[model samples]
Each structure stands twice: as structure tokens, then as C-alpha cells.
Target: MIAQRDLARAISAVENGHGSFAQAAATLPETARTAPAYVVGITGPPGAGKSTVVDRLIENFRSAGETVAVIAVDPSSPFTGGAVLGDRVRMQRHAGDRGVFIRSMASREAGGGLAPTAQEAVRLVERAGFDVVLVETVGVGQVELEVVSVADTIVVVTVPALGDGVQTIKAGLTEIADVFVVNMADRPGANRTAVDLTHMVRESGRETPVLQTIASEGQGVDALFAALQSARGGATNAARAVRFEVLRAVRDRAARSALAKLDEPAARAIFASLAAHACTRRQATDALFELFFTGG
Candidate 1:
């Protein structure tokens, strides 16, 4: 059995972009890939009861004889370098379940967006024999759309009374929700919110499916599961290939840009020298620029 500390170290290694980490991630059996696990993303506004919904979802999956892994990203505290990670505590009932592995990640000044490390973490969990992987992000505006980029199915959760539902739909969030869940369906206006969402999605000309759920009591969960299955069935190999090509292109461009910024080693050395000199009142910006550029 891999020790918990070792597992944590492996996750950190992958996060740091080490080649060995990629190799380690790949060694797990192809069975892990073929396993019936689904990578589901649950995201929404800050107070939309997303955590509660996730807790219920995990219970439903586990009861159906599937193992589960959860990666919950929590906002970081700039002053302390620590995170509240309160969502993990709410789902602590699964802590002792042999088939459940739950990990809470500190967003760590990663701008409350999907951390670069999250993809690596998902790879690790997928390889660990879990039949399902659930990722819950630290609710972020706009940039949270990155979740859909990594997940097999993105479930965007929202509530009716918040009055922010329409605005959220107007933003990019509506575009990425493969499954739109009107959580807290027991509240008034839930049906209106659902109808509004259905109409908006139809108007957008996207065929995405929407479902309503009183997630607190497991209401409407079966329909949500059916929608997820339908979406997964449509995930063809051709579509996957296109996504990979796009991601690779983006990565290549980023790499080239980073390399260009550091292309002049001698100029960088001179700038370091000038910076020290300026700190000591030995040079001004204009003088440093002229000397560095003119090689004088």
C-alpha cells in the first residue's frame, strides 16, 4: 500500500511539472482508464449549496457500488498561506470509507481559478482505481470555465432565489454547462428558474440538457444521472482528438512565449547588475537602459 505521505508527495511532484511525475502517472493500468469512472465537475456561485449537492452525489454513486475520489479546491488566505477548505468537513462521512479518497487543495494565490496543478491531480486520482472522480472548484467568476476544459462532464449548479441566475447564464458559465442543475429545487421559483434556463439554452442553439434537483434530499438525482450517461455516450474518439489538438497548440504557444521572454541571457545579466547599482544610487533607469542596450 502506498503511504498517505508518499501519495501526497506524488501529487506535489506532478504539480511542479516533473517528468518523473508524468511517468508515475502513466504506469497505472489501462484498466484505470477503461474503468466506468466518470470525471464530473460541480461548479456554481459561492453560496449555491454546491458542497451539499456534491455530498449527496457521492453517496448516490457509492451506494451504486462505485468507488469515488473527490478533489475539492478551496480559496487560499493570502496572509496565512492556509485555506479554509470547509467543504471537505461537510463530506467527512466518507472519510472512513475504504472506497473513498477525498483531497482538499489550497488554491494558493492561483487567482481562484482552476489551478495548473488540478489536471495533474485528476490524473493521479484516475490512476488510483476510483470509479468516479469529482472536482469542485473554489467558485470563481468567468475563469471557472476552465473546469469544463478538463472534465468529462461539467455540472453547473445554481439556485433560484439568488437573483444571480440570469446574470450567470448571460456570462460564459451557461456555455460550458453540459448539465445545468437547478439545485435547491424545494425553494419557490425553482420551476420558473428551470424553465428560464431551458429557454435560454434553446435560444443559445446548444443542445445541452438541463435538470432540476432538490439536492439536499436526493430529489431528481436519477434524472441527473441519466443526463450524465447520455452526455458520456456522445463523447466520441473524434471529438477527443480535436480537443487534444487544441490543447497542444495552446501549450506550444505558451512555451514559445516564455522562451522568448528569456532569450537574451547577457542582457538579463546586465539588467541584474544595473538593478543592484540603481538600488545603491549608482545608476538611473535611462542610464541603465542606454548602457545595457549600447553594450557600454
Candidate 2:
């Protein structure tokens, strides 16, 4: 097994786009892929008690004698391109637990709503011998659905305040959410929200469970833990996740290579003009191909 410090370094290298992650990851035996760690994705809208839910989960997992790693993704500051990483503060009590590792990451302009290196970071942690890996999103809106490609089980946490309607079902959330959590269960309207979610899940022919919880007081957390523990991920989900990761890596590498070959000044000018126009995406693609291939 790789040392914890080495695993941390590998994740850092990948997050920084330093290319060392590939080399470091290659050192692990092929068996690492077969005996993969369970990855759980915790996502919901802002102020939906996602952090609190994750905090409770960390406590529960640790108490059950399981080693856990957390990747809390926070939105990047547009001005400074840095993140406050406040999730770490909420989970600081676990700092002294050798079995639990926590990482704060900034969602740095990745289209998928996760830090581009988040998947690789999870892989690094899993290789370090953690039993469970929890990924917490920035709680942005629907874009958080990207987590479906990275985690084996997805826990979608929402509060009772969001009001029931098709709105809750938007963004393909119903299709991807393995388990739905209505947090702040002690608050009014919690039962209504859970009922609505249950109705929607049943209507869609899925057996997804909607559990109610007051994460702050640890109410109903044990049930949520049981639901997560019992989640059965089929081979199809595993295959899809692996395929998506491979495709993303290939696309990123190709894009980097293309950018490296472009004339910086010319590329900048073209992009600036494109940004000001009402050009469709296909049109922009054609322009890029013309410029890059036809030397226009």
C-alpha cells in the first residue's frame, strides 16, 4: 500500500495538472481496480444541510470501525480563483482521527461541477486503503448531477423548504439519485416533501428510498447509514463510471495538446471575437477547425 503522504502528493499533483499522478498511480498493482473502495456522493442545493449530513456520516462510518476519506468540494471565488474551503471547518473535529482523511477542494471552472481532478483524487485515496470515500459537491444546482459518473452510490439531500413540484425532479435528478434524503426532518413540511419524493420515485418505477433526517441533531442518521450500506450497485453502473472516466481523461488530454499547438495571440483573438458574437457552438467548432487545420 502507498504511504498516506505519498497518496496526498499524488492527489496534489493531479489537482495541479502536473502529470505526476499518472506515474504515481502506475505503481499500484492491478488488483487495486478489482477491490475498489465504495464511493458515496453527497449532493444537494446550497443551504440544504449537505455539510451537516456529511459530518454525521463521517461520525457514523468511523464509529462502525471503517476508514473513511472525504473530498468536500467548494465553489471557487470568481475574483481570486480560490475557495474558502469552509467544509473543512464543519468537519474539523475529525482532524485527529487517523482513520479519517478529509480534503477541501475548489471547483475550479470544471464544466462537470466537480473539480476536474476529483475522480483521480478519489482513486488516490482508495489506493491508500480507505474503506469508504465520500464526495461532497459545491451544492450548486443541477450541475451537481455529474457526481453520478464518479460515485457508486449517490445520496441526494434536500430540505423540506424547497416546495414540492416537478421542479424537484428536474435536472435528471430522479434518474440518478440512488437515495433521497429530506434533511431537517424536525422542521415543518418535512413529511410532505418526503411523500412527494416517494410518489415521484414510485411513479418512475424505481425503488429509491426517501429518508427524513435532522442532520444537525443526528436524528435519523442511523437509518440513512443503513440505506447507504445496503445500496446495491450493479455491474452496469460500475462499467459506466469507468467508461466516463476514461473518456474524460482522453478529452482533457486532447484539449491540452490542441491548446499547446495553438498560436497564443491568434487563439486569444479568435476566442474574443467568438465570445462577442451570437455564434452557435457548431459554428464555433467549425471556426476552430478552419483556423487550426486550414491555417486560416
Best by TM-score: 2
Off by over 4 Å in 2: 1-3, 26-34, 232-236, 239-296
- Error (Å) of candidate 2 at residue 194 is 0.7
Once fitted onto the true fold, the runs of candidate 1 whose alpha carbons sit more than 4 angstroms away are 1-6, 16-20, 23-33, 78-80, 164-169, 236-296
Residue lDDT tens for model 1, 74-133: 788779877677787678778778777787777875763556677678777766667788
1-296 in candidate 2: lDDT tens per residue?
A: 45557677778878887776677676554334445788998888888888889889999999988889998898897778977778886787788888888888889887565787898888888878888999998876765567877899888898886866676666565567888999989889998889889988888788888999999899999999998888844452576577877887888787886788567677666677778886766777777777666777
Best by lDDT: 2
Candidates in order, TM-scores: namely: 0.75, 0.79
Candidate 2 pairs with clashing backbones: none
The total of clashing pairs for model 1 equals 1
lDDT of each: 0.72, 0.81
